[model samples]
Target: MTSNAVSIKQIMTTEVLTVHPGDTMEQVHLVFRSSDIHHLPVVDEEGRVVGIISKSDYYSISNAFPLFRPDLRAAANDRLFKSLLVEDVMTRQVATLTPEDSISIAAGYFKENLFHAIPIVDKGGMLVGILTTFDLLNYFFNQEVFLPT
Candidate 1:
């Protein structure tokens, strides 16, 4: 069964914020800090999806700075942010979907994987949107309809 028995385009987020390979961790950090999004699709100059950065990925990488140093932690984190690039840490082997893909297929992807988000791309591999588990929840909760058994 799928959501609304339709394409995930109905629930995917089109106005997605992104980061680039060359971007500093601090730059991406600001975006993560400011937004409620848990995943950021990393795109190239041509807007082609190259990789993805999850909030957990960011935190896990940065957490290497300290175990619990309240004082040195800030400076260490700041240093890491300045030195590391998005490409240096992002997951390069990202799974992507098209806007027209079936919601059931995407739900299956979510069910089978540990990741929570998938970047929506065009036939040419240009990113157009993103779909997350949370988006599916919103669809389930907000829609007046559901796929019948």
Candidate 2:
């Protein structure tokens, strides 16, 4: 099927890893470091997508407060980093697509924007999945059967 024919549900990753608005920056840092994905959808208490956090954001803040090798200094730095909330740094205005959106729509987004990821939401505006340029590339290069027209 062409990209226009294939819905985002077919390619979007449903196993979304999300953070809450009140989550500590240090927790966001750990998630980014451990996960292979670069972008995180920030959700509210009700699990609705509220914002987005990129690896770049994490690095930008964490790097500015680098921990010293000394235990005392490292502890102090760690405390400072942990005190910041994800809401303080996450992008409040996020671009999102519904599960019904087609791959063609996602392609258009990637083409026109600098951001690499888009959160997928359900009809109720609840977080459902995430789509990234990597997903698009993987679909085009590895899954040739679904190549766009």
Candidate 3:
């Protein structure tokens, strides 16, 4: 089959690292550092995705307020940053994909959007997996066993 025929479920990662709206910024910071991922899906108590957090969002907050350093002007912002929650910074308007969607569809989303990752959810809007550009690249370059002639 051609790449266009390949479904996202075949390439998407079922084991996803997710966060909640109530998670603290510090907790998200540590998760970002530890997961080594660029994006995370924020879910609600019922497991429905409500938002998304990207590494750039964290950088934007830091650059806008400079929370890491103990400089003169940043003191007030630093305190505020520490007290801030993930929901405050995460993008509430998130783009998502379904498991059955084709990889071509996901590629189109990536081409149209500035983000590199897309959250894969079921009909109930519950997070099931994640798909990233890296996953696409792996399919193109490394999944030689399944690539069609």
Please tell me which predicted candidate would have the highest TM-score against the true structure: 1
Q: Give the TM-score of candidate 3.
A: 0.85
State the local distance difference test value for candidate 1: 0.89
- Tell me how far the alpha carbon of residue 100 in candidate 3 is from the true structure, in angstroms, after superposition: 0.6
Report the C-alpha lDDT of model 3 over 1-149, residue by residue, as the tens digit.
Answer: 67788999999999888888888776777787788788888999999999999999877765674545558536655565678888998899899999999999999999999679999999999999999999998887766675687
Off by over 4 Å in 2: 65-77, 145-149
TM-score of each: 0.91, 0.88, 0.85
| Tens digit per residue, CA lDDT, model 2, 5-100 | 889999899998999998998888788779898999999989899999999987787666455657665676588668999899999999899989
Which model is ahead, 1 or 3, in terms of TM-score? 1
Cα RMSDs, all models: 3.0, 3.2, 3.3
RMSD of 3: 3.3
For each candidate, what is the lDDT?
A: 0.89, 0.88, 0.85
Report the lDDT of model 1 for residue 50.
96
What value of lDDT does candidate 2 attain over all alpha carbons?
0.88
Candidate 2 or 3, higher lDDT?
2
Clashing pairs in 3: none
Give the Å shift of residue 102 in candidate 1: 1.2
